[model samples]
Target: MQNAGDWTRRLREIGIYAVIGAFLTIISPYNGSGNLPLWGAYLYWTGLVLTGSLSAEATRTLMERTGRKFGVPVMLALMSVTSALAVTAMIILLEALTSGRSIPPGYLPRLFGLVWVIAAAVTAVGIMIERTVLAPVTEPVKGASPEETFLSRLPVKYRTAELYAVSAEDHYLRIHTSHGEELILMRLADAMRELAGADGLQVHRSWWVAKSAVRDTRKQGSKLSLVLPSGKEAPVSRTFQAEVKAAGLSA
Candidate 1:
């Protein structure tokens, strides 16, 4: 369900970019001095914008996975550099393929600097639009508790999800929600603390299981596993056996 919402939102963003690209195509910026026809210029700019948007999204996702949180200045610097390189490469390829003309290597440095300025300007416009126009209206209620607000740290898809469990995976947490599962860069101890509002317990050093999601308990060989409503099993460590048993999962 949430996955479908994510896809829908992504498609909408792409559509919005396409519309902007079409308008930029009509304006034909930087094309007046070029030899390409109006239609050719439209195609080139539209493709460039689409590709640039994809590259930006990819960069953001990579940063999230690697837990790279940059300040505004650093973020802007990175975006400017990345956009310039990506957009310049795209334009070079398009020009080479369509007009059989390649930009001289010697001119690339100057071209990159110019494109970086334009990319930075465009990024500013994007930020303004996001803050003033595209921002969602679902703000937190006036009296919402901090515990309830804890979900805000989760990805948009899981923000309102019923959390089932959070398992530690190195520095990342494998979050299990009623709808699905997702990985986030967070510590298990920290996640457990934030999840204090939920009726759950730590069954092992690496695993936290929601009490409501526990369907049963079963012994497999020398290990004990807590069965979830989804039929998935969460292992219980020997150190937590007594506590887990006391929680009424002896079956």
Candidate 2:
């Protein structure tokens, strides 16, 4: 489900970049500045800008996968620097080929420096659009009613109850809320998807607990478990011990 949302955002980003590229090309100050025809020049600029945008997105993805913690300024700096380098390299190569000019000695550095300035400008615009426009459009509004959020995914009777934990029982899931426990036909993975807005995580392959429902955590030798509001214990597998501890649920 997260991947679906990412894909949707990616498509929207591409569409936006394409439209901006077209607009920039139409009003380009450098149109027909060289041997290239006006139409060809426009196409070239539009394609170049779109290519740069895609490169920026790829860089952002790589940074995210690295999982390195960074503050806002640091993240922006890393992204902008990487994006500028990638786009500048591509632009230099493209310009050399399209302009039919041999790589001028001692001119490469100057060209790259100049191109980086342009790439930096484009990256700034892209970041602004993502934070101000795309983010607001994609993210649910703040202070949403609980009834309209993850709580609504429970069975009709349990909908208004306080959520505790979810346990996978073979092909079904057993939901334990404040009201009572009930078995439902659903996968833990799918249930987690529906509980996106909830503050929780899978403490084991078969168990997911709401942070608020955890009354205590216990460690028996190498194993860990969470004690819920209903006195039900949810085991935490070794695989998830780190996550449980990160949530400050470890004894």
* Number of clashing pairs per prediction, in order: 0, 0
lDDT of 1 by residue, 4-97 (tens): 5456656766676777677877766655227667677667777777666566656656665664445445555666667768988987887787
Reference-based TM-score of each model = 0.52, 0.48
**In model 2, what are the clashing residue pairs, if there are any?**
none
The weakest ten consecutive residues by lDDT in model 2 span 132-141
Clashing pairs in 1: none
* Candidate 2 lDDT tens digits, 1-251: 56775687778887877776666666663332245666776666667777777777787778656745344456566666676667556666776777766657597677666656666777777776664455422234367643235444443566678888889987657778887775545678977876776788899999999888999888778878899988989999999988888888774
What do the candidate models score in CA lDDT, each in turn? 0.69, 0.70
In terms of TM-score, how similar is model 2 to the real structure? 0.48
Off by over 4 Å in 1: 1-8, 32-37, 130-154, 157-251
